[model samples]
Target: MMERVHVLVVAAGRGSRAGEGLPKQYRVLAGRPVLARTLEAFVDRDDVAGVATVIHADDRALYDGAAAGLAGRDRLAAPVTGGATRQDSVRAGLDALAARGAEPDDIVLIHDGARPFAMAELVARAIAAAARFGAAVPGCAVFDTVKAVDASGRITGTPDRSGLRAVQTPQSFRFGLIREAHGRAVAEGRHDLTDDAAVAEFAGHAVTVFEGDPANTKITTSSDLQAAELRLQTALLDVRTGQGFDVHSFVEGDHVWLGGVKIPHTRKLSGHSDADVVLHALTDALLATIGDGDIGSHFPPSDMQWKGASSDRFLRHAVERVRARGGVIANINATIVCEAPRIGPHREAMQKRIAEIAGIGPDRVGITAGTSERMGFTGREEGIVAWGLATVRLPVTAD
Candidate 1:
């Protein structure tokens, strides 16, 4: 049987260089958190037995928010609090694994939480190299010219690029061996070592190298984050737009629900559900973008289970369906045609409610309200009508 490998992700750094907002690991890449994507890369692998993360003492809330939906996964361990340095943070992660009964000779791969693009093939290579050589790191061939400069800013020497390599993580090692190397380094006051390989060499252990992918770039600056965003957009090249429209007649009530928000009105819309025309139309539009069945097909009006249900549930279900197909909702726009309630006063509230339900920003959800100039049922104040448009991005897959 193949041995299961443990993964340790270090995310304790403040990321001061990445800018002034949240830490780089907690920053949004595309739509999801960077650390969330990194954790997904390891959690989705069957070969990974467990995953642990080291975080700053004050980042528990941030980590929890980043890992919100993944908290239930059995293989994800509770985060460990890290110390001042990167080496200290790595040791904290390793010890957390040990406390959970990791064996002495088991393989452990330490990775950076900011590097979200490390693929499965690279991880497989790291695992094989660690099993064979006991200590291994993934390294890419240096493609640019190498220059050694002095502190005085004078040109020193140009080295051969052919022999140089740019090392990246998932730096793999035997669990017990790396732990002992770290302990020895601490005991001898060797706190200046930068990486785990240096600690291994200090303990007289030979480390080998495996092929690394250039796409496994770490996000350290604003430019890197922008590049990652472009890469994600390019990967999801299949863009689709879908439209939906729904109308509901007026009923005797003091309030009406639109776009998951309740507004004071002379009468409520009449339908099988809460009669939220905006949510129903938006849900249908989102489903259409993913080629899923319409809202009526998923939640039939004839079904007693959907009677008087909140329309937000329908929209949330459509969002889940889009995600299941590996699709991202680029934006949603809706126009409500009603003369009675006056939609301008509640436009921002409607947009925020829909954004919350769809897991997107309010800026991505647009809501506009206008009347039919006394021509249609909406202008006659008899009912409400909504037209919805959804733009989605999906990966191009084999048919």
Candidate 2:
């Protein structure tokens, strides 16, 4: 049987040095909270069995605000309240997992909530190293010279940098070993152990070292946060704009759906589903931005399951697709072409509904209405048409 991999993120620190009113983990980074991005890094991975966080006792509200929309993820466990020190916080997290029946052979990774840039490669290496060595820590080799100073700040000894390494987390260990190590530390009143690896080493365990990624830097100050934001912005420089147009004929009905809103009309639009032209066009536009197939390909007209289905489902699925790719919908501009129903009265409601479905702000959704100037099929009042343009920002990839 495979050993399950679980992640424990330590986020209970007050982080007063970050210079933000909120804790460093809760601070906004690239339009998302630092803790949210950190949690997603683990939750989105298929190899990770589960993820739990240790939060400050008073920061429950802050943690919730940062972890908005992630609480529903299947792999995310309820957060545990931390004690006074970092060691205490990790212990609390481990205890929570044990209470949930974690096996002794399972692997647990102790990660810093401030480090959000640990790539999948690093995670795989950590898991492999822990499985092979029982207790493993990641570290990067130091290049600069090192010195030991006395209390008065005088250099006492010059150390060789070639033998030095700066350690990093996701320090991985067998669940039972680390739990027993932490328990021993608690019994011995050794609360000053800085990290999980130290706890293991203090308990006479031989800890192995694995390579750590330099990009997985911790956010300790305002400057680090700024650099991380800039890095993320640079990585998401692939901006794309997609256009989609949809038309549906008028049929015999008293109401029509547009942009997920039901409006009273003399004739409703005819399609397999509630023919929401605006939402359909917007969905296609979003899918186009990601190069995914069109609405018909995803939800085919031949599929009876989607018969009379609400178009909001389509738009919501598109939004989730974008999110899955780490893409952001910058804005959605859609033009509604119709002669009847006076779209002007329902424009605000339409924008709000579309925004709600797209998981963006109403201000980011632009709704424009126009007539076909009595020339085309829309001009003949036979059908309603919608054209949508979606702007998206995605991380640049080799593909």
Candidate 3:
């Protein structure tokens, strides 16, 4: 069996350098907390078996609110309280994992919770390198001339730029090796080490260097946070809109399901699924925006397994497809066209349900209703129809 890969996110810093008030890790970046994005980088992957976050004892409420909407938050171990220093924080995380039954041979990646842009490819490289060598860290070659300056503000020496590489986490190691190294440091009272790789090196472990992405920059100041926001906007340059329309004939039933809500009605919509016209239209709209065909192409009526299935499943699938393509649902506007069933009472419920399924805030979803002026099928009170418009933001290359 392959050894499990665990991640320890160190976020216990005071972050005084970033700014006043909230800590940098809890700061909003590209619509979410930096720590939440960093956690997603590890927890979203199948190769990672578990995740542990080390947090400041005073920031429990902040961490909880920031990480409330994370997709796989249940996979995270109960957060442990960090210590006075970065090294101490890492040791606390390691100890937490050990208490939770992490094996000695399991791979541990110690990451900075402030760096939210660590890509999956970079993580894979670190894992591969750590498996080959007992310890490894991600590094990028220096492109600018480097100078070592003294406290007097004079250049002490100009180092060879070609030989220097700027390193970034997550620093990977065998669990036993890093734990022992940290223990040794504690015993010897060596608490000044900056990174985990340095601690491993101090313990006489040969640390290998792997390729690191320049985009995986750490947020240390207000300017760094602004730059990260700008970078995210630049990457998500491709925005597209898609419209979907779905109709279902009325059948004999006391209640109708619409947008995952059950409403008392004289007749219900009929279809292979739960016949939620609102959700069906929203699902197709999301899929169309991502160029992933329509809802029928994914959950065809010909498939018996989907018979009487809740339409929320279809909507959830469409949302996941958008995420897989590095896209986000910027806004969702759905309208229900019906004559008999009044939708005003259930509009808020519908919006909340759609927002939950799409992994976005309820404010981003809009729900409205209309009548067909007593002309067509909906006007004749024989069926209901729904139309949805979806705006999606995707990475430019994803187009």
Which 10-residue window of candidate 3 scores lowest in summed lDDT?
65-74
Among these predicted structures, which one has the highest lDDT?
2
Candidate 2, clashing residue pairs? Answer: none
Which regions of candidate 3 fall more than 4 Å away from where they truly are?
1-3, 11-17, 20-40, 43-46, 51-89, 143-163, 184-193, 201-204, 248-275, 301-311, 339-353, 373-384, 397-399
Task: State in Å the error of residue 118, model 2.
Answer: 0.8
TM-score against native, each model? 0.72, 0.78, 0.78
Candidate 2's C-alpha lDDT? 0.88
RMSD of 1: 5.1
Model 1 C-alpha lDDT per residue in residues 121-175, reported as the tens digit of each score: 9999999998899999999999889889899978799989988889999899989
lDDT of 2 by residue, 1-399 (tens): 667999999999999999858889887776667887788778877788899999999998777655644423678888999999999999999999999878889999999999988888999999999899999999999988888999999999998888788999899999999999999999999999999989999999999989999899999999999999999888899999988889999989999999888999889999999999999999999999999989999999999999999998888778778878888778898999988878989989998777766655567889999898887888899999999999998998895
What are the lDDT scores of the predictions, listed in order?
0.88, 0.88, 0.88
